[model samples]
Target: MWRLKTHMLVHTNEFNYSCGYCPYRSRSRSSLQIHERTHTGDRPYQCVQCHATFSSASNLASHRRSHLPPVFSCDVCQRGFKFKQSLL
Candidate 1:
């Protein structure tokens, strides 16, 4: 007698990666790593100018732009921006 191998279908939305420290779950490994930073208070990304740290790289980049002088100024709100596209 031979045994047949079968596969079961699982929903993609299922929470596979769960946080060991807290009540959190993520579908992907990368998302779990970012979520874990909240509980662990880990800042892998750091700013060069101010020595400030952030959990995400994008947040650190946005913070660095603040130190630069604004080239484009808004006429209505009087908000200064480094890039012109932001005004639009």
Candidate 2:
């Protein structure tokens, strides 16, 4: 219903949300806000365990993984890896 209508905007090239700082346009308001951060240099999402900050929550989440224990370990070098693909 409502969700499908929003998704269909991509096919129609109807990016109504325009950035005030740049020529970038987004289908959603949240996406536009994230893009605006590039112009403002606003890094509000801070890591609790570190001084690292990011403009977006997703970036902060990925950074948070550094504080976690590695899930996989290399058999040859005995080195640790957070992602299984990294081990291979």
Candidate 3:
């Protein structure tokens, strides 16, 4: 199964792909593929408000927060952020 293969890869410490510019390593080929985009200046995610781009979906999600209202407010200062998870 896919889970077994993924676990095997973790145990093997196989880093078949490496970053050319830096010493970044990854166990999965997909992670290496996405990391390579960073060196190549390939940003697939775009922000509509500022027309900014990011290489990963997680980055894009974080960027989108600026456009939306803050979900969590500081207890003392009342400072707001779009993500409640960031409060931790």
Candidate 4:
């Protein structure tokens, strides 16, 4: 989901950032670094409340919000969410 849209258009050779695990490769170093997190049990972002960890800061933030009561809910499914964007 994190892979760039441009990656679909560009070839692997053009984007030399290859993954050590599989055939997965990315053009940006940040993309590669984030991808590598899947193989390495490295979770820099940690939730202070539960001590749960996440590879990305955004994911960590999302998990942190889960601990809180829902501020927003989906009109169709009535699913509650803490963030307004989560509803969208």
- Give the winner by TM-score: 2
Q: How many residue pairs clash in each candidate?
A: 0, 0, 0, 0
lDDT (Cα atoms) of all candidates against the true structure: 0.81, 0.91, 0.86, 0.84
lDDT of 3 by residue, 1-88 (tens): 9989888987786887787778998887778878999789999989989999999888998888888888899898888868888776
Residue-level lDDT for 85 in candidate 2: 80
Model 1: which ten-residue window has the lowest total lDDT? 1-10
Q: Report the C-alpha lDDT of model 1 over 17-88, residue by residue, as the tens digit.
A: 899889898766777898899889999998888899998887888888888999799999999898788999
lDDT of 1 at 72: 93
In model 3, which regions exceed 4 Å deviation? 20-23, 84-88
Positional deviation of 77 in candidate 3, in angstroms?
Answer: 3.5
Candidate 4 lDDT tens digits, 1-88: 4456566646545776899998998777888898899999788988999999899988987798789989888989999878898776
Clashes of 3: 0
Write the number of the candidate with greater TM-score, choosing between 1 and 3: 3
lDDT of 2 by residue, 1-88 (tens): 9899888887997888999977899999989999999999999999988888999999999889889999799999999998788976
Q: What is the lDDT of residue 46 in candidate 2?
A: 96
> Each candidate's TM vs. the true structure?
0.66, 0.79, 0.71, 0.66
lDDT (Cα, 0-100) at 75 in candidate 3: 94
